[model samples]
Target: MERLLAPVKAFLHGETPSSWIEEARRPERLAVVLQDHLLCELKAAQTAVWLLRRYALDKGGSERLKGWLRPFEDRVYRPCLVKEHQAMASEVTPAGLSCRPDAPLAGPLVEKMVRLIKEELHHFEQVRTLMLARGIVIEPIRASRYAASLMQLVRSGDPWVLVDRLIIGAYIEARSCERFAALAPHMDEEVQRFYVSLLRSEARHYQDYLALAQMASPEPIDARVREIGEAEWRLIAEPDALFRFHSGVPSAL
Candidate 1:
């Protein structure tokens, strides 16, 4: 586990605040934590698909990708069929959408992002299955400012904007990896095993984002990475009223 997290630890400016971990450990907070986690997984997959459509895939490829995600999206957007959605989650697989021939970075981007989307959706299913087993309802919860704030740092223009977004993706994945490791020990055996199980893929997702950022950039991304990492650190270090998977330190704590 430590081996998997070494790069994640090195990449981030800070660890999840001990206060946030403490707040998450409370039994009452489990449902909300898992709920937010499931949502985050969907969001992660959605972001990867967006990247593929914008920079890698053709129109046909993009639409095909969307079809692949429909059942999962339905689970959230069309909540009337909650039981149906839960059953459909495990069946999601990669759509193998081809990339645009001329986009220089399309091949790697498509390959990495597709795998990322697949894993993330699988994670969504896993978390949702756990929630169902525990009788945890998927209630509506507000999003944290963490991702929106980081995205605000993305600069304007084509490749630079793409690179910046990829860098932000790295930080988000890295932070998630760190938090999973930090929270694992405090959770019940099943939850702990699950969190620990996620470390490898989450850590690789972080690396994939970084690699894509570097590939997209004309120059080195170290400066931009540090700049964005600093902003992500501030977001985590600040006090937040809403408790979420990626929220800052809990204000109530």
Candidate 2:
């Protein structure tokens, strides 16, 4: 944990605010925390699929990937589709991930992202199961501005575009890892254990994204990283109207 924290701590510009942690740990807010956590897991996998579709896969591969994700989206968006797609939840298989021969860094990108997609889907299922056991229903909420705000800071065009996306991915994963570690002690036993279990992969996801960004870029990324890290810090440190899992400090505080 010490070794992992060194890079992640340096990578992000700020810690999860004390006020947000207080809000997250409140008994009345557990449902909101779990609900947003569950949806973020889904969004992470969907983003992985999108990356593969745009940068790695060919036309046919992209279509097939979309077909594969339809059921998951259906289940997520509509409560009625949950039972129908429940069986498919446990069936995430990266058995047939195909990448374009001409795609840059094809093998590494596909391998890392496919694994990420599978793990994220599995995590999604776990969260949903826990929700069901607690009689909590999955409801859609407006997304927190954190991710889109990070994306806005990414530079426009070419290798920089790709590098910026990768860097942003790293920041997101790092923040999630940090937040999980921060929140664990305050949660119920099951939730605490789940968050603890998540730290390892979440840390790795940040590393993989950064490594991929370096591979994809021809120039140094240190300055860009620091610049974006500051943006991430501001996003987390600011007051917010909504209090989703990844949201900033609660306004009521």
Q: What are the TM-scores, per candidate, against the unseen true structure?
A: 0.94, 0.93
State each model's C-alpha RMSD to the native: 1.9, 1.8
Alpha carbon RMSD to native, model 1: 1.9
Enumerate residue pairs that collide in model 2. none
Instruction: Name the top lDDT candidate.
Output: 1
Candidate 2 runs further than 4 Å off: 83-95
lDDT of 2 by residue, 1-253 (tens): 6677777887888889999999999999998888889889888888888888878988877877777667667667866765554445345555576778889877788889878877887788789889989998788778889998888876777788889999999999999999999899999999999988888899999999999989989988898888888888888998988888888988964
Candidate 1, residues 1-253: lDDT per residue as tens digits?
Answer: 7888877888898888899998999999998999999889999999998898999888888998887787787777787755563444344444557678878888888879888888998898899789989999875578889999998898999898899999999999999999999999999999999999999999999999999999999999898899999999999999998899999989964
What are the Cα lDDT values of the candidates? 0.88, 0.84
